[model samples]
Target: MKNLVFALFLLPTATVGSAGLAFGEDSRQLATLPPPAQEALREEMRDNLVALNEVLSLMVAGKVKEAGEVAEAKLGVSAMGKHRSKPMDARPGPHMPPAMHGIGMDGHKAASEFAAVAKTGDRDKALALLPNLTSACVACHFSYRIR
Candidate 1:
């Protein structure tokens, strides 16, 4: 059952990859945002990757609480508030497709939930939630492209 669940999650990503290869062009839908907004979004995504790395490092170091703090500060719902304060031209949410926006929101929520679990200082508990947090990102990336 676990293998099946993993395979199901990978199926969309695999399909998208193969389709892109077959078409000799990107097959994902374009997520149309202004250049500034695009830059902002890209930067935010980079930060998210850094934050995830930090969380994993902390977890490996037996600092589950610190990992939770990092997750909350960088990827959770609080990060959404920071996003709102971006310069007008850099606000990506209003410009994104509804589906894309929804996926992003879900990812943030998942991050928040993961942070909450991590706060319990149970690394196993937090690890169990990581896939839920990351799947939102996988779903969106396979479904849309910024360019």
Candidate 2:
């Protein structure tokens, strides 16, 4: 009976741990770039997505300090050069709207928050924060169409 009770108690922790690892895997997969870029801007967007996934996976794995470092590095990479204003001129058409920059920025913010929560070593807090981090992806996708 004691063994059965202990097994039951361990189930939820095991499930949550597995889920966290699964999320990390999924985030890493999302970071991959498509083969061959015809235009510079398209390549930039693909690279940014890859960078975002790197930071997100680190957050899910409870590596906040490393995630922050990755985030800063990604920001620097993404911020390189001026964004072209015209859609036809932009590599990946249609161009992202000026207002939609918030979507990408918000995703980074959510990733940062998730990493901070995970660093506390509280599984409950990390789990609770996970959905917010994912929602940023959905929000960005809704506002920006990727080719």
Q: Which candidate leads in lDDT?
A: 1
Error at 107, model 2, angstroms? 0.8
Which pairs, if any, clash in model 1?
none
Q: What's the TM-score of each model vs. the native?
A: 0.85, 0.42
Candidate 1 ranges with C-alpha deviation above 4 Å:
1-23
State each model's CA lDDT, in order. Answer: 0.82, 0.52
What digit string (tens of lDDT, one per residue) describes model 1 on residues 53-124? 998899889999898999898988888956577887789898899977888888888889899999999899
Q: For this target, which candidate reaches the highest TM-score against the unseen true structure?
A: 1
**Clashes per candidate (backbone, < 3 Å):** 0, 0
- The worst-scoring run of ten residues by lDDT in candidate 1 lies at 1-10
